[model samples]
Target: MANADDMLKVAAERTGELAAPGMSSRPSRKVAVLACMDVRLDLYAMLGIERGQAHILRNAGGLVTDDVIRSLSASQRLLGTEEVVVIMHEHCGMNGGSDDEFSEALAADGAHPSWRLGAFTDLDATLRAGLERLRTSPELSARDRIRGFVFDPETGSLRDVESD
Candidate 1:
């Protein structure tokens, strides 16, 4: 199995290939996409985005955490990224069970004892919570646009939950 460093080296090589000469000239659409870290979801291909088009911020469940807000803030101020797309997908491990259930499972598996899963099972509720979190975050620019989406992993379809 490849170690973390090995995986990183492979990723760097792939990124370098995509960022070769003439690739830097492609205009970025100034979009920020918040997506899950699920290997099954490809943010670039799903959005029809080419190289250097948007800034992708991924986490466990695609929830709008403080770090995401901070990154989005920086992207808005420095990277010309003003539009945000928060994508949560179907069949997500994050949504498979309740927070308590997940926490218990983690403990049973000898994971971190302090692990407390964030509640994100309800699709609509999770989307709304994420949207509201971004909208109300002081770190975000006042003029920034935010949208929510639900990606179907099985069908490879994107459904807009709410547009800006």
Candidate 2:
């Protein structure tokens, strides 16, 4: 696990070099990308997008949860983003995981949350479902350009997912 103090120290040291001058809050590409919070998946390099090119939203499993919808709505309506890219991946931790067991574990710790683990066995199907959800959602102002993909970290390959 990374130490917060150490991370902060490093960030403070590099803060001067990390400045992005004259970059607007709005994405230059007018797109929002929702991808897994996996350490190996470098969205900027993988998607060939720069820091100011797209709004990047990351979560476990890359599932299209309510919060993701909220962010997407804001990205499209407020941030001038018109397209969305959903990227699920091969060998995800969510694959074949048990949500009920996870919930029970949380309950054992005396912490009960309303959210599910968003686990799924099929990566392509899950991506397609998330894409469909986004496409049909009334919350997002721009749904026509939404696309989904499956990334293989081992092979460094990104494959497009077709909605069923």
Candidate 3:
């Protein structure tokens, strides 16, 4: 069976165990968190966030892409999120990866895209750049509170990244 099938079976076994019956769609904490899609880091447990408390967005490397900005725009404007937190982690796949290789692979498959793979060599610098992008983006309603961090999966700890 597929992994999704296994997940479905578990969901069936625990139906309503994670349900929030009366919780509002808006985040109670009025914050939005963007993080890498790393299985080792559980955002809820790491950040002490519960369901309906904050908006959590995840993607490769947790770099601030255009799509992330778009989501943040809606998160702050429509969902009332006033703070933003970005978390990239140590040993991320995107770290030390090659965008050229990724693009060439896509080209071999006869695909062409406008966006480049956000690969970075320096974790802290990348985090700082992403934080700066968030801070300068007029689309985000609350920019002053935007912060970035680098998670150490080995130690299960997060180190703050200073932005310009």
lDDT of 1 by residue, 1-164 (tens): 75999988888889856556755432388888899898999988898997778888898888887788888888887777778889998888788658887777887998876545666658768887899999888788744578899999899889888643
TM per candidate = 0.77, 0.94, 0.94
Residue 109 in candidate 2 has what lDDT? 98
Task: Please list the residue runs of candidate 1 whose C-alpha ends up more than 4 Å from where it truly belongs after superposition.
Answer: 3-27, 101-116, 142-144
- Residue 40 accuracy (lDDT) in model 1: 90
TM-score of 1: 0.77
Tens digit per residue, CA lDDT, model 3, 34-134 = 99998998999999999889999999999899999999999999999999999999999999999999999999999999999999999898888899899
RMSD of 1: 3.9
- Residue pairs of candidate 3 with colliding backbone atoms: none
Report the lDDT tens digits of candidate 2 across residue range 1-164: 76999988999999777888887989999999999998989999999999889999999999999999999999999999999999989999999999999999999999889899998998888888999999999999988998999999999999889834
Candidate 3 to native Cα RMSD, angstroms: 1.6
Q: What is the lDDT of residue 133 in candidate 3?
A: 91
